[model samples]
Target: MSLFCHRIEVKSVQTAGIIIEYNPMHDGHLYLLEQVRAQLGADTAFVGVMSGNFVQRGDFALLRKHARARAAVESGVDLVLELPLPWAVASAERFARGGVEILSATGVVTHLAFGSECGDAAALERLAEALHCEAFPALLRRELERGDSFPAARQRALAQLTSPKDAALLSDPNNILGVEYCKALLQKKSAIRPLTVRRAGTPYHGTDLVGAQPSATLLRTLLRSGERDRALALMPPVVRRVYEAEEAAGRAPVFRENAERAMLARLRSMTEADFARLDEGREGLYRRLYETSRSACSIEALLDETKTRRYARTRLSRMVLWAYLGLEPAAFPRQVPYLRVLAANGRGRELLGRMRKCAGLPILTKPADVRELPPVAGELFRQEVRATDLYTLAYPDLFAAAGGTEWREGPVILP
Candidate 1:
């Protein structure tokens, strides 16, 4: 089809990169990779990314990162990098920063690619520019009081605050993330040119399969039901063994019903002063958090009870994660210095071996090497381990392999 075959050839990939969670490899992603390669050229190296135990949309990856990475390689990507938990758990801005930082750190990556509703590189950049302006935030607050979702409020705020040329974003979560990608690229002032492609056939939040590809949301629903046979059917053939092995060993992915209880308990146990240290819990957010926790039984309950015009659900999600990690509210890390490798394909494995010759940061393969990270990063990593331990509680099957057991150095790979 002309639509999926559209290609942008990269004459030479100074470096072409993508930040992603191939939660399950699907046709939409197959199209995305085709676009990335066409623009960057056939010779252009494809860099894949796989999210860890905790994922961006607030859950576990149905198949582990390594399995997912190998699947990307089989599908046509040349390399796969891990979006480490420290980054995988944070807010969009933080997630974007860590992602962009790692990609830019590759020293050769010249362009960053993403999917968007608008699909115009020039327009997204302008929105990013306005977002950084002085008047945007003030106007943003005014529109937010209309009780639109935080995304809608930001878009309307941008509409009134900026020129007529700037079309306000219409509350799309994928497009919103695309905006964050632009924001991070600009923030770092990196040389990586930003590119965007229009998403096709289905909306990101759609739950049905648009064609050969189903939304990650739909795939998650199947996995959540413990229907591996159904979910695995959509995945690349290479990932089947991994899932089957996990199933046989009674080690599989499952989302916990009460993963946030400890975080809620942390919030409940803390004084108002304690909540102030989290990233979004500043500016009296802790006050709301404390008040909400009094009547709520869960994190979603707290959000439902207290979310208002000024606070967004995304902010609340980050706040819960931040509190669980015991993050100092005031300080979020500026960059991810350690570009650790949680998983890789054969091509990616080669890249890791060669990166030491030209890279700026350490490329790690195991958790032990990450021990020297700064206080927040180290603590955050530890929280991820605890989160992993906590995550395993949801699946009785996983205990046979890595239960409440501590995480070890090597990756848990399926042969």
Candidate 2:
């Protein structure tokens, strides 16, 4: 259960891992897989470490992780590993670190591929190096002291130290996360090389369905508005099938608005001390949250009330969700505890077998396996269980909403 351990030698076949949320599997994701596979050759296994019911954007996924994992495997991924709740909902730095740690622990991956607005891997690595320098901290601190947001401060610091082209890359969301992935790889000193595919089709935050590959945000909008056919067209055939099946069973679309009441109630019951324990909860922000929760009728209202120039709405939303889920900053393990398999095809199963021998961390294939974890790891696992229970509460079907789906559901096996 040591947090930082020596990296073990990889023993399995060549594999590539992608870090993703896949709120709903879309063609853009498939394109990345295709590009990676084409570059690496079809023999190379593709593993995806995906966010669970919750995501980094500080919200519940449009569909559950299992469903999304299944779609991923059906479309192209050889395997899908669950990125635990704590890290999945964390900021980009932690999210990237957690994912890189898990993928590295698997002892099979040779490359870490990610979508980047700036497709140059070497350039991103240089940016990562600059950001990791000892001098960057003092420069960043000065920018923060000037009241700039964390992202803005980091960007300003980078601009002062690096080329304008490199600094501008941070402004794009995909590039920001891509830089973090590289940073995490450097932090771990992992042997896994980083690869980036230029983002195509729609921008990350675009709202319109442009051509065949619409943004996940646009697809979510379409699904929420009952425009199923339109959304389906933006995804691959296999992914479309999964979405259609989930919707038919009354469990496809789960939005933030569905949890508004539960979120507000959870916030109202907590004191400033309780809020103080959440990530990014500090500097009287907990007091602001406590006050806002008392009068704000909805999650949106509470967000609007508490959000400042320094804090983005997405950060506020994540904080509220963390408070609702009773997640404390200390609850996260210093190192990722395990790689929980969400879905796997035959080739994936082979990779798992090789991983069992060399993986530095435990590889969990079922819910029962969580019980064998150390106290710290088990505590983190329980957070995921609670997250599943809370997430199911948003399902359209009452039976599904009764909870405990995490225990009953196993890794999705695709033929």
Candidate 3:
């Protein structure tokens, strides 16, 4: 049978893998989860590989990762595993790869489900295949040389190699990520089949709060602006409760600006060599960042000075964020080392039973469990510990921002 046919004809219980940041779980996110169950089966388990303290967008998550994971579990996900610091803040390609690797390592996940504008897995796969063609690289280089940003250049190259309709998929944020998911799955030769649900309500980056499904960007804006009720209205009831409880504890609505001075202090103290060490592009981007840091008083100013047509603002922001975290570009592992459980429901417990027997990577449900794993994995977990400590500094209340919470907190278990 064809792979597409085989993907949907799975005989065993389906466990759908979702890659998420869920900066805040809103109705749109809930709709995607429900859609997965609707299309796959009501009993289908959801295993989410979520970005931890930081997100792909190069900012602190609107809420702590554990709280967000709790919201996810309460909303319907069976298990939520962390995507880890390195991969969490990396480029889209690496972020997708890390999440995909985690789910593939689980061994129990039957499919990868995500929201996309196109919502056509086969189309994304075709685009993925086209990207892998030998001719695509030369075309990409041509576009890059024309002074386009990496994302813009890649889209331009794809447009050149494929029909406008196929290349147009890259224009939408969700479809771009969907294509990356397909590419990662193909590159790894993973057994997990790919699936997509058409995103409902608001567009990916939409800032308007008019629709049934407002974007997470809008929600974050509302939360940071002290509009709690407005933000809560967009989230699921369970998620709203979770945020309310977190806010009561002085832990909700963590923003990057809250910790700006600390990040600025860290960046200002770094040497040119240090910046160079963290440069991924090897194209003098970090050098520009270093020069900009000497005069730029705020993060926004630094980003503005460093950003150019060739370097997207988000790319520069990731660099600055990584610099503050002391994470060098070369330090990121190509594959996620371990599955760190962040939150789980009762169904997640059963899923864990199956994972113990079949998971390709080590699973860490407790902080102490790292001692039994390889040193590499242990060190990686330690980085996450440090990252959490820094993340807490962004909390509204410094009393709740104490270090060592990473080592103290285990998975959020729900009844």
Q: List all candidate RMSDs to the true structure.
A: 5.0, 3.6, 1.7
Candidate 2 structure quality by residue, lDDT tens digits, 1-415: 2122335455434588999998877888888988887887777789899999999988989888999999888887899998988889988899999999999899888899999988998888878888888899999989999997888898889988778789889999999999899999888888888889999988999887666678888888887898878778777788888877887888867887887888888888887778777745466677777888888999988889899988888888788888878887675667787889999999899889999999999888888878888877777777788888998888777565767777778999977
**Can you give the lDDT of residue 388 in candidate 2?**
89
lDDT of 3 by residue, 1-415 (tens): 1223334455656899999999888888888888988988888999999999899989999889889999999889999999989999999999999999999999888899999998888889888877877899999998889887788888888987667788888989999999899888888877788999988887878878656888888888888787888788878888888888888898877999999999999998999999998789899888999998988889999998888888888888898889888898887766677899999989999999999999999899989999898888888989988889999999999998889998899999998
Sliding window of 10 residues with minimal summed lDDT for model 3: 1-10
User: Which ranges of candidate 1 are over 4 A from the true structure?
Assistant: 1-14, 141-149, 161-166, 225-229, 239-241, 258-273, 279-283, 295-302, 371-383, 401-415
Q: For model 3, what is the C-alpha lDDT against the true structure?
A: 0.88
Give the top-scoring candidate (lDDT): 3
Clashes of each: 13, 0, 0
> What is the TM-score (0 to 1) of candidate 3?
0.96
lDDT of 1 by residue, 1-415 (tens): 1111213344544446788887666667777777877776766666645566667655556655555665667666666667767677677777887788888776656678888877787777777777777898888878766766667677777776555445455466766787788888777777678878888755777776676767777777777776657878976565556566666765555453435566667778877666666635345777787778776887778888777866776577666665665555445455665666655556566566667777677766677766776675566566557766655654546345364343464542322
Sequence-dependent TM-score of model 1 = 0.82
